[model samples]
Target: MKNADNSRRAFVRFLAGSPLFLAAGIDGKSLHRLITGSTRDQGEAFDLIDQVSQDRQISSPGEALDIFDFEPVAKAKIPPAHWGYLITGTDDDGTIKANRDGYAKWSLRPRRLVDWSHLDTSATLLGHKYDTPIVICPLGSQKAFHSEGELAVARAAKAKNHLQVLSTVATTSIEDVIAARGAPVWWQLYHTSDWNQTRAMIKRAEAAGAPAVVFTVDLIGGSNRETMFREAMNDTRTCTNCHSGGQPRPGVSGRVDDRDNRRKPAFANPAPGAPIPEAGPPTWDYVKRIRDTTSMKVFVKGILTPEDAELAIQHGASGIFVSNHGGRADNSLRATVECLPDIVKQARGRLVIELDGGVRRGTDIFKALALGANAVGIGRPYIWGLGSFGQEGVEAVMMILRKELEIVMKQCGTTSVRGISPAYLASR
Candidate 1:
């Protein structure tokens, strides 16, 4: 009984210094009572305390325990419609779940009895070195989640030395994001039907110091995002103030467009019958055309098959971004991680391979690297931080992932990112 009392007292003291406790501004007595169950009846069955205030919600960025910890905070802070759009997947939402579940098919094989006092997590892609292999995947209209939007994300990326891929429909401009990042960033292209406009956007990105252009291709035809529609129905705010174009906003409806009239200066004039420059899909020729149009490296985003991966090389792509548009592009239920090995085999070191979709852990990043991915990407995790606590939250998420990755590296006996390979992983 004395030991138990001492343990409870020590735990309460530890909680007093915890980020969650400090940020939540809980008093020592309250924390002590919460930990001791002082209000409970003596010898009562230990179960859920229905009357206790939930401690899961974080009040500040420092309070976040992991990447997922920010989700509820973000959900609570962001409007219902935007939160729905942020979490939406096409049709049945099976693909979103699959992307996360696919990691279970593989297991890690850690090396034993290796000294790992000094570790490295740096990765290189297209001749550029970054601190970590975790790239910030393109997320459009980040302002819908937070006021600072991509700018805050860029600052966090710069601080953590992670590469950021800016979306075509990003709330902030390319030049500004670059300025905030203090480095060049890759730009994601939508490849709309207007060839002239596409050429102009590509050139514009190159002019803004983007070293590469990632052309997203899986969103052919359109998607049936029932989740976004359902959430938007509950939004009580007036849509017309910003979405005056009589169309669902880009991020809200999953439709890419310059409804805010932000792209008129950089985008080309509308071609015949193609009023929306961000609409329509492209063929392989578009890839070749983009390559021809710019000296910057061209990456083919949303390549999920070995055939498409091979096609990307033939079409003059500098890299293959293995993704399913975060499962928003289709209802195929194919996770990007599941497609990595085959695509890596087909590429055969011919191009840089990167993937993003449902990556929430350091082990997921390690598994991707082991399967021959030069780098990995993340979408919702950082945004969760961004929405909850702006720039600080973004930095917290990056550091958390990096620390987790470092711990995994030490356990696996790998000194650096390049040292991780298929030999360290086994099929489950």
Candidate 2:
């Protein structure tokens, strides 16, 4: 086993250095030659497991040419369990595929013979100016991917002058993530049954200079996650799922914000070692409760149906955030993009409409904006970058997205971010 591991690691280095590997990756000719050359390697499953383990331990971040580059590296480098948790949607993965493939359902209407001299991707959301409309979704358990975790993401977003939303379940404490940012960060509140606990979190966020509150309404309880179950992100002894009404064993706890140490945050969300609260659903009363507690602009996330979007706005929501919880919230396979147009029409410009899930490329962002999403939220792409290359890797991913969005915007003959509309879209 030892000999095989060392040989495989060496092969990984060779592949990484080879120019052919840059475009095709390790599964190309070199890999076949190595495996076929050894009789022991023949008829035996080579999972590339050792290579993955080595990459996670190495000092260097893997080579990254684009956002997609990070995915394979992350899967290879991180523990199978951790990577599985990050990438897995719900059962059947219909929503996951939808998020990625749904872009093909519509085509871009590129205007020609127009002035393509210069372009700007600058976007303003909820009165904040971002270099681009790309916002990182509030993904939790960051330390599971990289040592720097959410801090790495915060630094990257600050470096790019982009918006970053911190999950309530973030491994890095809210104050710590906020402290790491040069620009302001938004907070994603997992509204718990205990409104008092929820209020405490909101108050802490406001004091720490969080400009907005993304009240995620999708995950009231645990969604069915067979992938996570199989990957060891959960098990009998370590299942901290809210639906089970049990606490996971003590491990990988990110400190909740308590800057003054006067009052600690009472988190009621499902995370390692935290009790997943029995928060059933958000009501007008709950919305009012949130409003009564904080002055930060509140955007209700997890909205798919038009009636729900309209009701949220009517109940004093500042914006409608459409998300499928990255396809992790339910068994439904419908991607958030499919839900955007109805949401946009029902909200009818009553509030800012932001989207999360399946935002993998620059053209994906273009499609979202053209369909009426004011801003697009990215989840897994940044994590893949962070897991593979740390902070610099994340920064690289953002740069790629910005450059790609700029190129596509120019192709469509649109220069400004808000200038994007249905005019730039055609039926598939």
Candidate 2: C-alpha RMSD to true structure equals: 8.9
Q: How far is each candidate from the true structure, as Cα RMSD in Å?
A: 8.8, 8.9
Query: What TM-score does each of the candidates earn?
Result: 0.83, 0.78
> What is the overall TM-score of model 1 with all chains considered together?
0.83
User: lDDT of candidate 1 vs native?
Assistant: 0.82
Off by over 4 Å in 1: 1-55, 246-253, 257-280
What are the per-residue Cα lDDT tens digits for candidate 2 across 239-347? Answer: 3332132332222211232221112232533233444354556665677667767899888989989998887877778987899888887867787898889889887
Query: How well does candidate 2 match the true structure in TM-score terms?
Result: 0.78
